[model samples]
Target: MNIRLHAGTLLFAVASFLMPTVLHADVFSPTMSYSYADGVALSPDVSYQFNEGIGLSPVVSYQYYEWPGDGVLQLSSSPRVSYLFYSYLGPTPALPTAFSTTSLPPTNMVARPRVPSGTQFLVYTSGAFASGVPLDTNKMTIVLTHGWMSSSDAWPKDMANVLTSQGFGATANIVAWDWRVNANLSAGLEISAARTPSEGEALGGELLYLLGANYNKPIHFMGHSLGTMVNCRAADFIHGDAKNSPGKIPGSTLKLNPQNTHMTMFDEAGAVGVANALSLVTYMLFLPTSGDTGDLINNFWTKVIPDHSAWIDNYISEVGRLHHEAANVLLWRRFAVPVISDISSGLHAYSYDWYSNTVAAPLISAIGHRFSFERNTLSPLPPSGTYFLQSADLIDSPFVVTPLDAATANSLSSGRALVYPTLQAYNGLNVAGNAYLNGLNAAGNVYLDGIQHAGDFLYDVTEWVLSDFNGQSAYVGTGTAGSTPAYMIPAGSAPLQFFWDLPFTLQKSTASPLALNGANGPIIHPADAGPDITNNTAVYVWLPVIVPSNTVGMSFEFKIVGAGTNEYMTMGVSNENYFTMESKFLDDGVWMSSGVIEISKYAGKQTQLFFSMNGDSGLPDGKLSVRGIQFLTVAPPTLNISVNGNQAVLSWPVITTGWQLEQTDALSSSNQWTDVTNAPGVLDYENTVTNVLNSGARFYRLKK
Candidate 1:
């Protein structure tokens, strides 16, 4: 997400926004342009502060240019000024140092800390699916998979560093897969899990060939969105080889138990298979939602209007309704011609033409799509610019029968595309997959590609990341082909271990009632709380989305079940905004209801709930639990320390790492610190330098 500022001079601080401050423009003015696609928009090109992590652009206005008689025409425009969170993690960039609880801005934490040259590799997992760095014999590999429309760059840098850091004596080897050419968005994108099983058998065969006995060692697999599917499919392939042809995988394949693996499902959003593999997974679900492909199409229509003018609106309403009913001949015609015709669309067009030409193409390409049609055709469509144009035109055009209005076009063009809630569902599925593999026990059912395709196999890639690669038991069940197996399917079980408690089942639609009678006091809903729930016990609230610093539509409401007079409970966020519930302690068991509260917003961000108690002990007894906690992304902490005179100073951002410090008296020469004594309170340099000669300029920075 990008934010624009009209003023030329601006100072972005950590407390203000979640994402790193990326100053895209050096000089700001009134007129600016933004390019909106899929779920996000790009601001006008400027001297961006990539290292700084904060983005500064001008607030742009949008309007459609229509022909004199044509009341409505398609147009593209930019978004107004708003604070945005740039990452699925914290808004700020990842820090280069070790983990900490300190709250520092991401922009100021980009200092590249010195890494030991003799760092070994044991903690990280290496990648074999997509192209990556050559594996070293001595280093442990950390394999990472990119999600739909995502790349290696998207992998949290901090995670990579953590994975690579030595725990005991193991050195880490980080491997990033660049599968763009293999899984092009619009092209014949291969579903990691192929239905026939033999379709990806070649890749599978090669994987076993490379792994051989090495498969015994645990290989950490990290993926997002579609990448989760890829990881699961790969595991299935390996599983099939072990079951069907043991010798094909080398060593004792079944002996490699998938349960012994250690997986960490962090910020995943994908399929139900993740939940199914609960027994063998360890998941740290960040933010999750639920959904499918057909739901995706409907969501876009519901949220984004293709046509705004009366004519287009009427036509679209009619056509779209017919299309839904499968009653429109034109809809079928478009589908058949584009999907079935061999003469018109080329091979690449048949597969990928949807990307280059349309505004929607870019959007879809930037994110990701599953079960695309281009891969199945015998004579695939060749690359054609028109196909892209046609696809984009289709997006801009209403399904019914109307031309687009200026506002409608502007909506499409505005680069500030907010992520649809349904997208979170998709993300949730992926997260579930990682959790399932990691033994994190997710909540959801398993669905492949959001489509019920036969033969799409699901594998547990986390097993590879968390298992002991040397000599480990493979199969959980005894061989049943020749004799009775030790383990049998449980009654009424739906793919045990593969599916765990998904959010669909974990979250309750009906909330628990507040205590009408208790010492904690009365509770009420935000609506009944009058102006605030600060004085009562309240819980269970719904927030649509996290807002930017300037967006107007930020609001929150909840119910408070306790009394407002004496002891009370309130809901709110903490310093970092990790959800927290505050309440007053009570001695006697008497409770009063304070009702619910609704808050507009501060700094344009939604107002969180809080409960305050009066007639009670001043201290809280940690009895409150807030369900549905939301957190904005935070930048990583990178501290650069240098000695000036007798004082130590530090500075860092997202990009530029190196820095120079000046001495108190003679600022002439400077020395570099390759190692750092990173302890509590102080950031000490790795090297020791005495103040022999006075220097002119002395600075320390993170090496890029």
Candidate 2:
């Protein structure tokens, strides 16, 4: 059984428990008082008598009498005499056995006890339950219980006071279950602890009555310390009784089941299995007291705390180390850290202070704990889930979901893979047979030995960076010669991002007729003549281009290292739909230059420049290799000319330093152009010159 503590403790200074001033009153009192109301009608004294007992008994008789009177009456004895009266005969039954009183008999009064004494629920109306305040059962009901050595007048009463004085006063029925007798720690811990279950049973009966009376009302139970155990036992007992005798309480849907019940336990104590039977909608544990020796061992101190000797020393300290540590763990896990600590008392009493003053008061005073309550209100109480409560320093504190651990993260990145059984066979071989196959070739292609059918397997020669190749039949590469072909180039190899997809293998061969710069280059040949088979496959390489808005044209260079008969290559800038400076089929091995292609039309657009090569039917040994790919862009001219009266000043940045100025005149097809005769001079990285605009409507341009 998991014991979850539900209530959080505040950092308030722990107040010493004030010994309750025991009140003495008649266990069974029958008295009469009368008041005369003017204009009230009065009838003759009418009386009704009934025998009250399990069986028809004349020993006990209850007589109820009433005299109705109306009209203005004087303050006289005669007027007071005409009033209603009730009388009971026979020995009065003993007060509820659950009540704490020295006058009552010590023997048990009933086999199945009902209500406990001093358990009257107080109603609050807008934070006050002064005289004449009516109770509205239509509102939500919240029952609070005090722990061992504590009376309802202590924390229970304080909780009620907080609820009423804070926001819940107008919206909820705050009931302080005064099972002080059962919780009397003065009698000794064991003796008082033994009666907690019975006290809980009695409380459960009273709750059943309330539920029956106020149908479908939301009810919540909050207990601190041992009181938490009492609530758990009570819920379990009530649910068991309900299940055994289904019709015991008529018209009540609340069966003490988890769905209908909600419980909050604060620093729980007592037996472990108290709340195991209860299926609550929500169970919360608020642990404030810590450093208790027992708690450290229970929470596995050896695992979390480093240095076993220190842990032992801390555990045996006068101050509870385990208890406090446990509290810190709980608070931290819930992302409610930096909580104020109260070390005034060694015992667990801070839960009450925190809950009543901090948790509950804030909900009432300033609609806080919005997520904990329903509809952002305290009236409905919280729905079910395990809530770990804490006194947050701020309403919106940052919560850490998962903490980073380098060691654990590293282990995950290097964990070994486990093999599972499967029926599929690879290379026409079972797992047992394929396990022995080894040795990958220079192209990072794995070939199975002793396989009669060569075409049964397909090879995907994509370059890989990692070396741990296990489940995959294809070889993983290290991107080096005599290994796998290199797919990625060093950063900044070329300005425009380029990606290659030409089917080829990296081979170290100095026997090539063409002079290749690198020690090795990609080579492709007819499928039948090579290790892999191929049909009429096309080789294509492209680079994505972000043509600047000010681009004028583009230039690039390419070389065909080697090509056999019927193999040709074409290079150009293609937007998929169109191409610029598309070269004709070049079958001969030669370096080709793409004399500047006008690309201003494609400026400020996303485009790709592609090189495609096709191998047609020819010699079976036909092969082709491409290299020396490069691209460059020409920028648009940036020239400015200002005119003042008859003279104009022409200037341009050094980027256009090699440009010449030209002027054209005439609006017709017949236009004449001339270069400016004035020499230019450089100033502030700008080429400047003065020109005389004597002609009207002359057009000027910078020619590169």
Candidate 3:
């Protein structure tokens, strides 16, 4: 017989194996709220009722010194409010006597309670009053919600505190919602899960009120685990309420459930709520951790629960594992040391501490998944869009967890498919001697090479996103060949004369030609020849030459740079038959005369001369100027042939340059050709060679 193990039993097995440290006992208590005076010895600057419909009591505003001691204390202000309401989304154990009798059928719906239930909200902002404060409406307003077994004072409070210390609290309002009473873990998972939507709706009502008050402010919602579901439900409710409203709310572009909010979900519990919430938010950032078992429980729940089974199943099949580790992936930004050991719940709890401690400046080190954002902090920010970041080691760094096997690397490198099947997939690591691989070809998705974790990526992403929100132009790269196209040298207006004083018509070219008359000829600047030169541009110049057959060598004279400057210029010669064979550079500012270059390989071929100027390394003023260019060709020695008896003798005037004697049966283009094997000896300037004429008719030529 096959026995199906339930979610609770599986969790029990997992817990038995885990033996996690008891951080805090699961506490179940009636909902309660304490004022600033009750919790701490602080006097309130102002007190007023907030969210009257939810029976939200009087909220007090206070300005507290940021740092603990007298090192350097700055008074920062954020209004804090605590309010409660009855949650209607939870399961009702019984129907009221007024609605049900012994014979009447029972109904799932129930009448609203006369008194508000214990759903609570705590708003933390840098503003002066509860509703209005000194904040930039154009900036983001962050709302943090906690998960099961945790109060708003847990991670949410910590996040708010960190954000405040990070200076985000000065310009942005940060709020934390507390639903600890309903989230009491001792009440059973099912009961607490049932209450999530109701508490979320209450939170949504408060958000709607905030939106109505500060209509233009953009809002971002961040939640961990169960709180992610709450954020989604709240966002949905807010969208629905705004859409169904009679009149348009000022400062808000809301048109009946408009998606204007940004939402980030951490290791979420339920898929249905998250999927639904996705529809109500404009942008979504999902972070799932590796080796988390939260998705297993969620997957098991889908099979056992009848309600929303299809939705849950779809979520499980599509985004299950991603939902479990979303928060874990973000911890790298908050923690200095890599989280290498902890599993499951222990791993989950570390996210809170990391986020809290992240208020201080991150430890900049190359030891972990940290990426250098120093370059990104420049004036122009990178474009706002999705970017993929891959880690070198997933087991330790954990940015993306795709196994980089040979097949995976090939697929990524070939761009045939994404390396990983999940969203966690990124371009493969650029191993030495291997081609760089990036999976997402979408224009918006950029692959960040070498960056490993979500925290570091997000830290950079946060700055980039903020810059985009502030309407700044994006920065890509400068001085690269891809960014700067090659510049061709144009033909001269007058026919140019070679070193032999033979005039040749100039060919049309792409390089820019200068009109400046120099001591020897027209002087040209590579920067001015091509398109406008930026700070770091590279330019190229091409010159075509028709060299007469039997030429053995070439010589040229040129000036590299202007006097007393460190500019650079390089010249190379190549023919149609061969690649660039001769390239030479002159580093000094003075002119160089009579530079000899071998052209024996292209002795009988037409050639094109190439000139390149690299501005990045050439000069501090970004100019590569050249003048006094002259070219000369060296003629080959005369060859004489004769026959004596059964032997063929060949003789040529020898020179210091090297040359090879070749022979062919016929001069036809398709005839077989070979190099003459008979050795030649040079006596003074005359060389002689003799070969036995044992074969058919033969033709000979001297090649250099």
Per-candidate Cα RMSD to the true structure, in Å, reads: 33.6, 44.1, 38.3
- lDDT tens digits by residue: candidate 1, 1-704: 21111111001111211111122223322333532222223335532322122233455322111111111112222243332111111121211111111122222111111111211111233421223223444433344444333445444233354333323114434554434333332211111111112212233344444445355444444443334444433444444422233433565543223421222221122211111111001111211111211111110101111111000000010011111111111111122111111112321012122221221232233111111111111122221110111122334432222222445333333221112111211221111111212111112112111111011111111111011111221112111111111122222211112111101000111233333213322232211121212332222222122232322111121222333323333323211121111121122222211111111133224332222222233322222222212222212325446668765545432111122223233234664344333322211111223333234544443332
Q: Please provide, for model 2 over 91-136, each residue's C-alpha lDDT reduced to its tens digit, 9 standing for 90 to 100.
A: 2111111111112111121011222542443333443332233445
Question: Model-by-model lDDT, in order?
Answer: 0.24, 0.34, 0.34
Name the runs in model 1 displaced over 4 angstroms: 1-141, 156-158, 165-169, 187-207, 241-255, 266-704
Candidate 2: regions farther than 4 A off:
1-115, 118-135, 237-258, 270-347, 357-704
Residue-level error in angstroms, candidate 2, position 149: 0.9
Per-model TM-score versus the true fold: 0.21, 0.29, 0.30
Tell me the tens digit of each residue's lDDT in model 3 across 1-704.
21111111011000000111111112111223322121233223333221212222334222111112212112222224311111111111111111101121111111111111323555576431132333345555677777666776566765676666667765666777776665653312333444555566566676666456446555666666567666766665565532222223555543223324555544444432211111101001111111212222221111111111001100110122232111112222221211111122233344444334323444332111121111112123211121222243434443232223444233223111101112111111101111011111222111222211100000010000000111121111111111111111111111111111111111112344432223423222222112322333233334344443433334333333332222333345542111111111123333333222334455445555544333334222322333322222233556789999999989875432466788988878688768888888643224678888976888888865
Which of the predicted structures, 1 or 3, would earn the higher lDDT when compared with the native? 3
How displaced is residue 295 in candidate 1, in Å?
15
Off by over 4 Å in 3: 1-119, 125-139, 241-260, 271-320, 323-345, 352-704
Ranking under TM-score, best-scoring first? 3, 2, 1
Pick by TM-score: 1 or 2, better one: 2
